[model samples]
Target: MLLSGHCLIVLERTVLAASPAEGCALLIGRRHAEALWVQRIWPCCNRWEPASERQRHFQLDPREQLLAQRWVRERGLQVLGAAHSHPSSPAVPSLSDRERSLGPTLLLIRSGLTDDPHPLRAWWLPEPAALPGPAPEALPLPLEAPLTGDLGE
Candidate 1:
């Protein structure tokens, strides 16, 4: 996926802002040829139920998602996928993440390790039931930061 440095910064800040809780956003952009260009990110509140599981789970506000869809449609962009932060884990997707994914799309996960040179990672996940076996491993996608060398871990 191709993302600008500014967008990366925005994603990091938005997700990290949640600190102990998880934060999420929708990736807004266009898909051209084989590349997905992330034009922007729409930050969303983590509305996971029970409140206590917010640290390990996230649910985009339905209202915000609808609004974001409208905004993207108006701008001729698509909601490429979703993004979220793992406040206490690595940039890799957790089992829960993979199990919950509706996929065949990109997923960007940011690690809590701020000091790490590359704290964010991207993955391409298949549909949950696309295969009959155990959940398939997510395919890693290289996150290219054109102006900033600060992504992927």
Candidate 2:
């Protein structure tokens, strides 16, 4: 989940905008020798979780996931990871989050959005065992320069 500071800021804004509910998106980027470069943020609607359950859970619509996968491929990139808001909870994954974990892909959670630190955390579910060695985890993934200027995208 190596991304520019610009992407981080964007994620923060998105989560805050959707406060009280879970905001979800796809982190698409290319793989580099030193890191997974996040080149784009694909915001997707949380489709499966009913409106009432959104405060605590998120379900990336299968349709959106397919579309995002296609879009990432079109850009010559891959699904580097996923991002979602945790509402008022801490940035730690809940038991349900772990139970539903697919393992391997970088999963980012933004929690405490209504307070200081507004933590945006990352984790490596089970490590991509197919890789030659232990692939680097999402955290400690270097933050690159801002992807844009204040002027706008």
lDDT, candidates in the order shown: 0.83, 0.73
Each candidate structure's TM-score, on Cα atoms with residue i matched to residue i, is 0.85, 0.80
Q: What lDDT tens digits, residue by residue, belong to model 1 across residues 40-131?
A: 99999999998999998998899999999999999899999999999988877777887788887789999887675557888877887754
Model 2 regions more than 4 Å off: 113-118, 127-138, 146-153
Global CA lDDT of candidate 2, please?
0.73
Name the lDDT of candidate 1: 0.83
TM-score of 1: 0.85
Where in model 1 is the C-alpha error above 4 Å?
114-117, 131-153
Clashing pairs in 2: none
